[model samples]
Every structure is written in structure tokens, then in C-alpha cells.
Target: MVCVEEYAVRVLVTGGAGYIGSHVVRSLQGSGHTVAVLDDFSTGSRRRVGADVPVEDGSLLDTAFVEASLRRLSADAVVHIAAKKAVEESVADPLFYYRENVAGMQSVLEAMVSAGTRRLLFSSSAAVYGASATSPVTETSPTDPSSPYGWTKLMCEQMIRDVSLAHGLSWSALRYFNVAGAADPTLADRGESNLIPKVFRAISSGVRPQIYGDTYPTPDGSCLRDYIHVNDVADAHATVLEHMENADLCTVYNIGTGTGTSVFDVMTAVRLVTGVDFECDICPPRPGDPADVVADPAKIRAELGWASQYDLGSAVESAWKAWSDAPS
Candidate 1:
């Protein structure tokens, strides 16, 4: 077992102004750690982070800027969360995905080496498992990503492992499932990318939400997914950081609730939360989408003592509250 250390440390969070990144910043700060943010704000918003947190506005592709920021902050660890994450967009433009997600990760690794920052907590994805994964996916599950986005995440995880072997960088890659909801209205997700927010956007525009597939082999015939709260995912990042020791440690864990909720169930939850009896359109199954992609969180629970505190209903409620309050 890797040794655990107890002390407050300064941490730099890349993409800290984004949805998940913002929550992570708050979680780390709540744990009494000094926190700073590094974001280009391409998809992130400055309003998500507090004024107390120092922001280093720049691109991670620029290794010099990232290195300078780490040196200036004297960071004890780095939480790398900056990456393009739209699966469809990645499929449309594989080159952009490789450059941004893959090359950008390399740049951060290089800057970490140059700046002498040893500790890292990477924001990986469950996409690495891709379609055909069994329900309740584990860390040891075979990685056969179906899309360019998942490929980039897998490549980045490998890079982190290789860097750890040579540079003695203590690291943990958290493969989180579908993250929904916000810590509060101010920190709400501003994008219309994922399922919950996409549905909210559709409803807000007076259009019925679209269910991609409804004839899967699930209990409800709709696809099942593990939707963990953004706050819980943020908390997992803090827990991994707190438990990391000063040794050359490389670890990976699945961050999720270990439960699957069908798409119809999510729509039902949305109606209950928003009190809107809006109907949904059933569409053909999306290519590469699995019938079920829930996480098997036993590893993180037993190893790091981390588990989700929010359920599907909680996620839908908070997401609706935030989306309803977001400005036009």
C-alpha cells in the first residue's frame, strides 16, 4: 500500500474554471489546501471560480506558460482537467482531439517535469472502456475505446504511467462516469453537451427532449448509465490527492456510484424535478453506445474510502435548479 501523508499542500488545478474543475477547486480548498487555477477559458467560465483563487490564464499546449505557472505557484501537486470532452465532436474531428487531448497532455507532462512538480491527479474518463463493456465496469476492464475521445484518454493515462516510471511522479488517474449537477447555481454547468444538460436545453427551448435509443436490453429497454454528481467527482479528486504519498506511486480508480439508471428513468426524474410534463421523442440507437456503462466503484471504496453521496434524483434536481437559473 502507498503511504498516506497528512499536511496541507498547494495545488494547481488546470481547467479549474470549468464545471468539474471548479467543484474540485472548492473541494480542495475546503480540505485546507491552498489552491490556484490554470485555464484558457475556451469552454470554462471565470465566474465558476472564486475571486480568492489566483487564475493563470493560458493554454496548456504552451509548455512554457504552464511551467512558469507551476514554478510561480510553487505547487505541490497538479490536477490536470483541461481537455476537449465532447464525444461527438471528437468523432467529427479526430485530428483536433488528438492535438488537444493527446498533445496537450504531453505538454503538461513536460512542464511538470521541467517545473519539478512531482504529484499529479489526472481527470480521466470512463469512455476508455468504450462500448461492449460489461455493466459495473472496473479498473481492470479491457480498454477498447470506440471513439477518438476515449482513445485520447487512454493514451493520456499511458503517458502518465510512463512519466511516473521515469520521473518518480506520484499520480492517480480517476476514470469518472457521467458527471451531472452543480455544487450550486453559481457553479452550474454552462454547456449543453451531456445528457442532463442537453435535455434541459431542449426543454428550455420548448422542444421535446430526444431519447437516442429505447429498445436496449435493459429493464426499461432504454440505455442505462451511471450518472454521478459533479460534486462527488470533485470530492474523489480531493480524496485521491490527500491519500497520495511522496513515493513514486501510480494508481487508477473508477469514480462512480456503481448503479445504472435508464434513460427513461432520467426523463422521469427530470419531469419530477422540474414539474414539467414535457414529452420526449424516441429516436434510433446512437452508434457505439452500449446498453449499460455503469461503474463498479468497489476499488475506490475499499482503497481510498471514497463513494458517491448523491443519487440520480439528486443529480437531476440540482441540474434542473442550475439550468433553470442560467441566464439566456
Candidate 2:
């Protein structure tokens, strides 16, 4: 059992019933810290969270309810993970994305302020740097969000910074790039959208998997991305919580494997893992797809002493195992 140092403080995880959030909850519990989960079950499932933890079923947009919940729980720190995430969906409905991702973050910040919770670990995304110039983007890379979903994440980062400066809160925003694989077998059943899961589903069903735009400026003529195991991402969250007290206002870190793997490479790995060769259809590039996006994890390593345990092969293996073990 990987245990977090015994901290008597209680931690609250928003979107705790979701994939990444559920893993964070488990990590916290394993570390001997008490955890409370707040989720609306919009994209999250109640079954993902452990049966023992208290899960408040409500939306983060409900300010009063959020405030009441925080007050009642008397949480020591909050890990905000709930948000609208799909890039294409955000493009279709920017307003909905802003409402859920931006507005909901505001409500959570206000509630935390009211409840006297000054420490937070925000689950930010690398989408903020939509077509970044640097292959391995550092924390200081220019943020040129290309999609509505990315814009929402940037907006939330600004919110966290402002709140931290004004209210003397200590916060860390982890800009995650390609959070792939599953930590728990049960939670893996709820996986969606990510390239690994999509490919796994198609290969398992003996259907052709579609690969959009193969003529990109890469070795394999496919877009490149840094794939980080979900377990590593979860562990980084706990690391942030442990260092929250000493952290300055609003620190940011890039969480990734610091290596880029192309779509073709991923498919090749998938084929090797499943021992099943499937056809792949090449379609026009998706509207917001970037040519290459990786992360420079030096800041995270220096600041939190965090490192990824799984590489591309290990990541694909874990994801394959999760999908293989899941019930149909």
C-alpha cells in the first residue's frame, strides 16, 4: 500500500467520483489522510469512489451547497478536478464550457475562501498551450489556447492566481498532458475519449480504428503527445498537498513523461499488446489537434520531487490490462 505521510488533516476532492479524481481519493486515503468527495455525477459515477468516503452529490455551480458542504466538512485542503474537458464538445458549445469550467471554478474558489480553506491543488490541463512552439513545454511557455475547452482552463488558472494573491491562499495548478492509462481496474471501466481507451475499445471489438491526419511534421507522420500514467498524475496531486503549506502563492507544474510518442507509435504498441492487427483509417486532421505537444517535467521534479514511473510501453501495458480486465 503506497501511503502518504500520516497527515491528520482532511482533504476534499471535487469530481471525486470521476476517473482521475477517484484515483486521487484512493491515494489520499492510502496516505492516511481523511478524504471527502464532492461530485455532481455529471460525467462522474458514484461507484468510482470508495464506499467508505462521504460523497456529496451536487454541482459545483451550486455556490450555497458548495459553501455549506465545505463548512460542514471543515476541509483542510481542496483538490479541484471537476470541469468540462472535451475539446470538440467545447467547440460546439463554448458557453456551456465556460459555464461549467470557468463559472464552476469561481464558485469553488469563493466557497473555499468562505470556508477558510487556503490550500488547493487544481487539476489544470496542457491544452492551455495549444500549438506551443517548444516541443517539451515548460511552465513558462506562452499560453495560446486554441479551443474553448483550453480557454476555459486558462481562465481557471487566472482565477486561481487571482484568488491566491488576494486571499493569501497556497495553490498549485498541474498542467497535465495526455493523462493516459487507468490506476484502478474498476474505475478503468468508466474510461472515455482518451486515445488509449478509444484504440483499446476498437481493437477489442475487431473494428477499424480511425487515425486523423497522418501527414503531420513528425517521424511517423502523426501528431505527437506526452502520455503520463494516471497513477503518476494521482501521485503528483498528493505531492502537491504535502507541500501546500510551504508552497508560495499559485505555483504551476507540468506533469508529463517528457517524451513524445506519435499516434502511429501508439497504435503499433497497441497491436503488440493485444496481438491483434486492425485497420486504421486516415481522416483529415481534427480542427484543434496540435502537431506536437510534450512537457518539461524539470519544474515538478525540482519543486515536488515527483517523477513518472511508467513510460510509453508501461503506460500502454497498464491501459491494455485495465481494458482487458474490465467487464463488458
Candidate 3:
């Protein structure tokens, strides 16, 4: 069994003010862990994390600031979540992605080494798997990234593995599929940049949402994705942190619901939940987008005892509630 309190882990969460990172910070705090947030406020907002948590306002690119924050927080483990995550934007500017995602990670690694903090949980993506013939991808699947964003994630995974092997740093890279939905109302905030939220925004504003590429080979010809709830993703992070002692020096796990939901299915769920009649305009497929990308979460389930509780409907309902209740 993993004993988190035995070590009394103090966690330093980079990008804790962002959408997914904020949820992770909330989950960590709920689990009785000391949490310190490091965010640049570039793509993240301090309001997302609220005022209770200490927010170290700085960029991960600044090695000095990151090292200083680690020393001041005296963090035992680091959950690195800061990265430029827009796939389309990355395709437009590959160099920016490399500098922010890859180089920023290198700085964080150096800071961790300096502070004697070894345990790390990295937020990877399904993009790393690219186009897979298999419906659901396993951790052992071949990585053939089709975009600059995907390539950056794969590069970071390799860097983490190398650092763990050479420097005795224990690491877990959670390769997440589509992280949709929102945290429960008690933890809701307005700053998120995912598909669900965008769709909600369109419906609320009396506009039809645009559907990218509805001609894919799926049940409804829309893109199919494994939509995991944000809370479930946060829970997985906490589970990994709690069970880090039992994990190997370098470990990778795919985090998802193990079921695929297409864009049409998600739209149907939204309409059912909100009673809103929204139209959609079919558009060409965005570059680097695969027809289907699901996850085989068996490895994570067996290794960390982590499983997703919310299904697609539940995820859509919760996300709708959040967007409807969002401050104007």
C-alpha cells in the first residue's frame, strides 16, 4: 500500500491555475496534501485557483524562479502541468511549442534536482499516440505523433524517462485522452479551453457550434474521443501521488474511460441535458486530428487502482451546469 502521509509529501503543482491543473490542485488539497501553485498567469488565471492557495506568479522558463519556488515550498513531489496545449496553434508555431513545452520541462527538471525533489507526475496527452489503427490505445502502443503538439508531448515523455533513469527521479506520465467535463459545482471556475466549454459558449450565445470534420469513419462520422471527466483525471493524479512509493522509477499510464464518444453523441447529450436546440456547421478536419482516439486504461487500473466514475452523459451534464452557471 502507498503511504502518502508517511512521507508527508508537499506537492508543487506547476500551472495549477489552469483548467486541468486547478482541478488537480483542488483534489490534492482535498486529500490533505500541502499544495503550492506555480503559474505564469499567461494562459492560466489566479482566480481559477482562488485565494486560499499560495500562487507563485512566475514562468516555468525562468529557472531561477522555479528553483526558488521549490526551495521556498520545500515540495516533496512535483506535478508538472504547465505547457502550451493548443494543437492547431502549435502547428502554426512549432518553435514556440518546443520552447515552452520541451525547454520549460528541462528547466523544471533542473529545479527539481536542485531542490532534491524526485517524485514527479507529468500530464501527457493522447496526441502522442497520433493515428492508431486500434480503437483504444494502450501504453505499449507505438508513438507516431502527427503534429508539433504531439511531438512535443512525446519528446517530454522521453526526457522524463531519461531523467528518471539517470538521476533516480521517480516519475509517472499520465497519457490522458480528451479531458472533458468540469469539476463539481463546489469547485467550478470559468476559465477553460476545451470542446465542451466552447460548445456551451456557442449555445448560450444563441449561435450554432461548428463541427470539425463530420465525415470521419465512426458511428456518426464525427470524431470519436474518450472523454474523461476532469475530476476523474484529478483523482488519477492523486492516486499516482499516493502510490508513488510502489511505482517504478519510470512509469507511463493511459488515463481515460476506455469508451469512445463521438461529436454527435456529445451534441445529443448536451441537447438532452439543456433542452436547447443547437445547430452545427460541418467543417473540414483540423490538421493533426485523428478520426478516433480512445484509451485502454487497464494498466492504470491495475497499477494505481484508478477508474473513471462519470460516463459521457454525466460529463456533459456537469459541463453544461458549469457553463450555464459561469459568471458573466
303 Cα displacement, candidate 3 (Å): 1.6
- Local error of candidate 3 at residue 316 (angstroms): 1.2
TM-score of 1: 0.96
Whole-model lDDT, model 1: 0.89
**Model 2 agreement with the true structure over 1-328: per-residue lDDT tens digits:** 3334544468889999888899889888877788999999978877688889998999999998898888888888889999878887888889999999999999999999999988888999989998755688998998898889999998999999898889988888999999877775777834566788888878777788889898988888899999998889989887777766454547789999899999999999988977888879898988777788999999989867899999888778877787788655
User: Model 1 misses residue 228 by how many Å?
Assistant: 0.6
lDDT of 3 by residue, 1-328 (tens): 3344663578999999888899999888888788999999887766678677888998999998999999998988999999988888888999999999999999999999988898999999999988763768898888898789999999999998888888899999999898877775534534444678778878888998888898888888999999999989999998888887555547889999999888888888889999998889898998988888999999989866799999988888887787777555
Candidate 1 residue-wise lDDT at 51:
93
lDDT of each: 0.89, 0.85, 0.86
The true-structure Cα RMSD of candidate 1 reads 2.4
Specify the highest-lDDT model's number: 1
lDDT (10s digit) by residue, model 1, range 14-115: 999999999999998888788999999999998988999999999999999999999999998999999999887888899999999999999999999999
> Candidates' TM-scores?
0.96, 0.96, 0.95
Measured over all alpha carbons after superposition, the RMSD of each candidate to the real structure, in angstroms, is: 2.4, 1.7, 1.8
Candidate 1 vs candidate 3, lDDT winner: 1
